[model samples]
Target: MRKIIFLSLILIGLGVLLSFRPDRKPLSFPSSRVLPASKKDLQYKTHSVKQSVVHTLLIPASSRFLVTPTLSPELSSLESFVQKHQAIAAINGGFFDPENRKSTSYVMLQGVWVADPKDNKRLMNNLKLRPYLKKILNRTEFRRYRCGQTVRYDITLHSEPSPTGCQLLDALGGGPRVLPELTSVQEGFVDFAKGKVIRDPLGSSQPNARSAIGITSDGSLLVVMVAQKPEAPSNSGLSLPALADFMKTQGVEKAMNLDGGSSSCFYYKGKTVYGKINQQGNQVRRELFSVLVIR
Candidate 1:
């Protein structure tokens, strides 16, 4: 009888401990829907992981991709871009300065350099940023190459040359490759020394809304957005390392993190989901300077 009582107490204690554990409960996604396209050529899914609702969209290699600019007088929202371009799907892309409305990330469209960091005087003239200008200018980017009839996608540094016979078509720059390796420090997302972070522009260790693009081994394109859980806004979202791990598990061969936080958003089939959530558990929406769209 005593043994039975002790076992019951132990079980109760264990249950209590688990109840207070982070990410112990799985949340259901009522907004998630599976859209059909070419059987499995295009897919979208919302997965509940820890404190985030991860949204993923996969586009087959046969589809065409474009790095679209706002093109208007100012930055535009993902929804506007989707509606204007009649895109099948869209994800926020690249970093930019909101104050001056200038892009800090490189963007190429149809073999034309649409956005260049050199044009952003605020970034280029900042004395504080001078030391890291080289890394900032050569951040990782998603590139599309056309070699005759064969088209391929790659995640490489901005300075990387296109494959021998291939013509560079479209490119969108983002920071710090996530898969294969985390280039947070080398890409200037963070400054680390002696195992301690001295400067972190993206809060590399904290949970925050994040967007990333990846290329699977089969050449399929993946656009992922990690949204903060509404029920646990402060404790939600994934860090850089966690994002990289998640992308790897999703079969990503190469990946790069895009401009995230309030700038993170995903749109498909007229439905849109923003990533960042405020302390009040409300989603924050912001205009984007560039986007990767499938039209």
Candidate 2:
């Protein structure tokens, strides 16, 4: 039954690919342009956000959320780190649903990685949303950082149930391959998740009070950043549209939304990106049960 569903999704994806015509072509930017350094050189200065229904974006009106990265100025030093951890060579990011558990602050790190499938088993062994430094030190690839995908989309996955418990996918890749786990968990698809080749349509989600993250195959990064509508409205320092627009501006070919809210956050380049914001504001807490860090 799962095989049947998987096949259907591949066909859908193929159809979408075949039906492709760029709505807008993005202006080219140097793909090699590196991000700003973390400056601190090693450790990350932590920040926080009060858990809330709606989350926010990195740069107001920015699609590209920057990570102050872990670095080794010397290749030998970098190689030493890579030897201990996993690593990937493409751009990716987004939120992840728990392996089987669900919650309000459930958004965890998820994205593409460069590692072995056996590593997947190891990662699942310690899968906790928002894991800590020591906890994250597992599955090191060549001593650097393990580069397995935050969200594992193997052939074994099945239907993604809606919030009300209805399966969206009727079929998937047919044989042993798994679908990408494409789902809205539907309140419905938001804006950022939509495609805009040139950033005009720069898709951003409709600002969910809660959300998570995930990555696709198109070399794009998604930040399922969310901001909850409070029981009583107050200053929520986060924003969107600009982030989605920034993503487009950054030349991401495709993007989308995920589960987030207080759960939204990322770790890369040695520094944590925007910290979690729940109801109040930035709240610094470590090890969120489950977090997908890019090694």
Worst 10 residues of 2 by lDDT: 170-179
- Per TM-score, the best of the predicted structures is 1
What lDDT tens digits, residue by residue, belong to model 2 across residues 171-230?
Answer: 111111111322222112222344633221112233323223222344223333333333
- Model-by-model lDDT, in order? 0.86, 0.30
lDDT of 2 at 171: 14
Q: Residue 286 in candidate 1 has what lDDT?
A: 95
Pairs in steric clash, model 1: none
Tell me the TM-score of each prediction against the true structure: 0.84, 0.30
Q: Worst lDDT window (10 residues) for model 1?
A: 64-73
Stretches off by above 4 angstroms in model 1 are 1-40, 62-73
Give stretches of model 2 more than 4 Å off. 1-233, 237-243, 278-281, 284-290
**Residue-level lDDT tens digits of model 1 in 1-295:** 9999999999999988988798777655755354335734577899887789999988877655443433332898888888888888888988999999999999888899988999999999999999999889999998888889887889999998888999998888998888889988888458769998889998888899999999888888888999998888888999999999899889999999999999999988878999999989899999888888876
